[model samples]
Target: MSQQTKSDYVDDVDVDDDWDDHPTDDELEATVENLEASGFDVEVVSDAEEALDVLVSEIPAGASVMNGHSTTLEEIGFDDYLGEGDHDWENLAADIWSIDDDAERDAARRAAQTADYFLGSVNGIAQDGTLVAADLSGSRVGAYPFAAQNLLLVAGVNKVVEDVEAARERLHEFAYAFENERAQEAYGVESYPSKELVYRQEGTEGRTTVVLVEETLGY
Candidate 1:
């Protein structure tokens, strides 16, 4: 068999021709509004870079922040910009299941529990404003609910689907596959556990905010 090089893999990839089935701008606008009505604060942006700027500006100083493990956010350079800031922010960027020391994991959980704001990405969000996420490590979804007083979700247009059914399909078919690849590349782990098992974790009561960018952001 021929050895598959990076360029060879890239060259062989076929793009999905699903654009023709995409909804119109008016439909998207109505969907956004409906999302807001369903108890989610949603903001629409033109691009990933703009979304990052808006996210940083919206967070106040002296606020603790928690981040989800998201390749999309990293691709857009959120960590670089966030690291440059001189605010009271705590980073919860650890593998959910690989914490060897209980004390260390406890400290990380405490930081998240006390954060003033939390930032993460959603696997999929429905037109009616339901946020969907699949996790193997409970960190990302676990910290979402009560980890902070305020919650901010950064999502790309690629993360949006028609409804819950489509969201679930994307989760199993696309989101999980991409997440597995990411985890392997970043942490050297191939598999963790059932995505459905991790999805059972729920966030605590907090003001949830979402920023949806027009461009593709994450898996």
Candidate 2:
């Protein structure tokens, strides 16, 4: 069977700028506080550097860390940051089921299973504190269930959509395109059809802790 391109599989989802009526910082703070009250550990940071500090401190020394293929992580220079830290960190970039190498592929799979902490982004998080995400490669989203002991979701304020429908739209409109671009750049393909897998799963990870950053972080 012939495979489809990303453009062929992804539905047209639009981002409504009207939804950009963001709350004030105080309101955002209160919302975050309420989420914490609901038993979800939440933190808000000003920028990527502070996020790195939080990441360093949250991940204990000697703990194994697994990372998703987060554009935000790459944008924030997490690869370099991980090198400077003393903890054991594994990059799951090659685990997306698209990589052709066997050993690197196996290592990525193992990293997803054995890591103490997993870090990535959410497609959308409701103002009421519900976390929403879509999975394409499955590895990035699949790892959430049994891959890591603790799941840390780092999302930008822009990712906060009004509802799940909006979240899905954002994924098709923004996240999917961004992710596809990265895939093309790395793999020399214009698109990958695996994106249809996104509709197969709900949220990833069992125990999830979300960190909402006010500024733009990841794609």
The candidate that wins on TM-score is 1
Which residue ranges in model 1 land beyond 4 Å of their true spot? 1-23, 86-102, 192-206
The lDDT for every candidate, in the order shown, is: 0.63, 0.60
| Residue-pair clashes per candidate | 3, 1
Which candidate has the top score in lDDT?
Answer: 1
- Residue pairs clashing in model 1 are 145-203, 145-204, 146-204
lDDT score at residue 173, model 2, on the 0-100 scale: 64
Candidate 2 global Cα RMSD:
6.8
Instruction: For residue 41, give model 1's deviation from the true position in Å.
Output: 1.1
